[model samples]
Target: MQHIIDMISNGTKMNESEHDELINEVSAELVELYEIEYDPDNLIPADDETANRILEAAFDLLEAVGVYSVDTKSVFTIPRDEIFRSVQNSQRYLNIGEGSDKYLLTLAGSSEKKKTSIMGGPNASPVTPEMFIPIHRSYAKYTDIDSIAPAYLDVPAGSAKKGPANLMKARQAVQLVKEACALEGRPDMCITTPPHIEDPVAAVSVANPRFMGSGDLQEIIPQQGLKVNYSELSRVYHYKMTGSNYLCSPMLVRGLSAATPEQFAIEIAAEALKSQVVYGASVFFKYPAHIHTGDPLKTLWASFAATQALSKNEICLQGSVVTSSAGPCTEMMFYETAVQTIGYVVCGCDILSGPVSNNGSITNQVSGLDAHFMAEVSRFASDLSLKDANYLCNELFSRYESKLNAPEIGKPFVDCYDMNTIEPTQEYWKLYETVIADIYYILQQKNRRISRR
Candidate 1:
């Protein structure tokens, strides 16, 4: 109640300040008061008590700080009662995809165990028109990857076309994704639409029910200052009407938003929880912003705290893996990918796998191989308890810790795979095997010995 009053008073002060100034100010101030309780000895915090404490910290941050609306130019005052009501109305089960391809995505917490589905594709990365089909084909063939969101839209790449024409380009992305899935015999796949398209009406105009159907998920991202803008608001409305899902991803960059780990985690929770409270969106994701796939320490800390907070309170899910300076087909790339994805799975996230090579800069820099590697790492990492998961993260981090700055951006998909055959070259497979073998050894060292084994 005091924080709500404070936010109102702060809102008056905001008028005297610029937008970016207020944003930068809140981001810097929010996490400064909280000290990180993350143990160096136990990085993942295996105890249930620790997770609960993290949840408590997150709620306090949410109630005290609340969310800022760039559009309204005022802070959103949280009526505690209404926020709780929205949480009570939070969704527990979600049906993704259409027809026989549909899957009931059940949300779970860090304490409860459930198989996290593999949501694969380019995400929103840019790719050349020629490579889109072949790249998506890579993910579609894998049974482990349940849904697809093809990256690198060929339609809107490098002025090859005119204005964003959001609807036209979006339709092309959908049409192209269908082609890729069809080649892999998975025409009934669920995929994501780019948020660049601002108008929900235009998006619906392009989404032909006969092909696009009603099962697709679109991203609804709030502005950096935690404000829900018209673009995301309309998309939420579109989902409410269509009965589709929106992947609410509020990425809190380490340096940009929060200076420290504690602040970063709190910001993530504030965004995720607010998304649910405001929009009734259940599928939430927290991706740490870094060029080199981010660090395991950062990933585990922020993801564990925020996601544990969400899970404790609502029928919600949080997710994994984003942003890498490292490109595909290099040994260094696999090592970084292995460490980061493993950390996210162990920290507990609904895994969304893909190597956004070159920090999602260039197309053909990503391949099906990158997505495959992410899936494998996340699946293997999920098997370990938090204690062993932490050990594995520390060990793997030791290998790539030095390479975080200016990571080796290796060759893109064209160099690594046989486009016609849609398979990895022998050289790539050999490197992949070697990386997996080393990771296995790391996991083995951490795993307690069984008397029988």
Candidate 2:
């Protein structure tokens, strides 16, 4: 509490009343969420009535604490106690008496643009040579995003037709960073690379030359005007070999067929823990329900449970994206937004990077909206107590468990928001604003209760 206060006092500006209001609102919603979603034994009920109850509870909670700002992208830093209180008040709906539960608050960056600095091949969609400049421009424009995970840079030149070559791809990655920096006037943004690489030496060769690593964060210093940074790869080595403070994200889909999504997530998280790597997990959800028949909520729960088991030092949950084959739709986008935000709050993820749409296609304008929605939800979720957050998540899962596999992918970005304007359309923005306003009202209601007490 003192640390947060000191940080805020020392130039980290925050409006006390506004902050308190926000906290109170989220807390009250969480309390209601607890009643509907969480069982005292930490188990979720499987019945439809319980599920519907959980959904109603979550809807109220979402109405209260789920909306966030999409206009300005900034990190919110507030005291944990306030957040915990908000959740406690919300839990009153469940009749759970408020008890002392120390919560921790951390700053997180919220930028939804899918600008990969690393992977640039056929495997990664919409990453054409022509699209590079535009994407770079987008990155440059969104200076609010603290870091960027450059896409996988292993594809050799002229290999798109023949598939990726064995030739080291890191050097090319360096070139891409340099290019992206040159195009964007500001080169201060951090550049990160994928952890799963075939050649560590080549990967290092490219990163060591471009990036400066100090502790967990890496910075890309412009050498002829370009951002550069290297992140350790963790996919190939698995968690057992790496021991875990590195980024280790195995594709959820790939692991799902052979092992349960939860089991795969646990195995990967365990490896990250062993390496002490600040890991990132990407959970991809495809459309039509034919791909994976499992429950989305359960899959998310398994992933969160795995994340919870790991040491905070070893693993920092970078956000998870709900990817679908059907491209970015409104329902899918919202579903992803709701689930990922809830996961971040309940699971205590370090950074929330996406709601990546079209399985990696930049063509989906809705992807950007999804990103915006994610940022808003993330901000709301950040203001949650760990216990209440867990309960909230359990409730969300209970309500949306069946729909996970066959989630309704909403409208594409083109339909929802105008791409030409580089902002959400008025209609979309109105929807966004309404959601946020409702959430604000919920917070205000909670604040009034706090005053009475």
Best of the candidates, TM-score: 1
Question: What is the lDDT for 426 in model 2?
Answer: 70
After superposition, candidate 2 runs with Cα above 4 Å error: 1-125, 136-140, 151-185, 194-205, 208-246, 252-266, 277-293, 311-331, 361-369, 386-421, 434-453
| Tens digits of per-residue lDDT for model 1, 139-217 | 8887777787668565543542334465567777778888888788777878766434545665555445754666777
How accurate locally is residue 227 in candidate 2, as Cα lDDT from 0 to 100? 8
Off by over 4 Å in 1: 1-35, 38-42, 154-164, 198-211, 291-296, 312-315, 447-453
Candidate 2: tens digits of C-alpha lDDT, residues 191-287? 4453234444444333342342221122111111000112222222332133212333334431322133323333333233222211122211111
Superposition TM-score, candidate 2 onto the true structure: 0.50
After best superposition, candidate 1 residue 362: deviation in angstroms?
2.0
TM-score of 1: 0.87
Q: After superposition, how far is residue 303 of candidate 1 from its true place, in Å?
A: 2.7
